[model samples]
Target: MRTNSFTLLRQMVESGMGIGIVFGRFLQVRRESIAFVELRDLPFASPPVACCRMAGRTPTVSSEAFAAAIKTIFHNYGG
Candidate 1:
């Protein structure tokens, strides 16, 4: 069930095997078989996400360099 493929996820959801939540920004009108429900007024707050880094361990040289570059990119992009 773990995948980064949107097409696979959408196909799975449409096949009635499971449900998937595609963000509004990513949803397209290509599939009439799939239904979308907009969720609102949740009891919890949902905040936007930034890059993620591993916790509680020393990062490898490559990882640290990658994180620094990604952080710089995010900084340049301004959130």
Candidate 2:
């Protein structure tokens, strides 16, 4: 099944339907019926979350300041 299908299954489980399997590191916060089963190990990978601006508009000074503050917090936290 596709990742979209898995997401739909998770939604159904959240909505009280009794079909489908849901699993992930963050799913622990979900209900108890949503079991956390291990699947076969695969190479670990994820996409980066990048920030970009439109050609006509620049990010505001406040936005830049907020980003810098977040970076400073992460650096202090050893992220």
Q: Which candidate is the best by TM-score?
A: 1
The TM-score of predicted model 1 comes to 0.45
lDDT (Cα, tens digit) per residue for candidate 2, span 28-59: 45444444333232233322322222223445
TM-score of each: 0.45, 0.32
Which residue runs of candidate 2 sit more than 4 Å off their true CA positions? Answer: 1-47, 51-56
lDDT of each: 0.52, 0.44
Q: Which ten-residue region of model 2 has the weakest summed lDDT?
A: 46-55
- Residue-wise lDDT of candidate 1 within 49-70, one digit each (tens)? 3222222345578756875675
Superposed on all Cα atoms, the candidates' RMSDs to the truth, in angstroms, are 13.1, 15.3
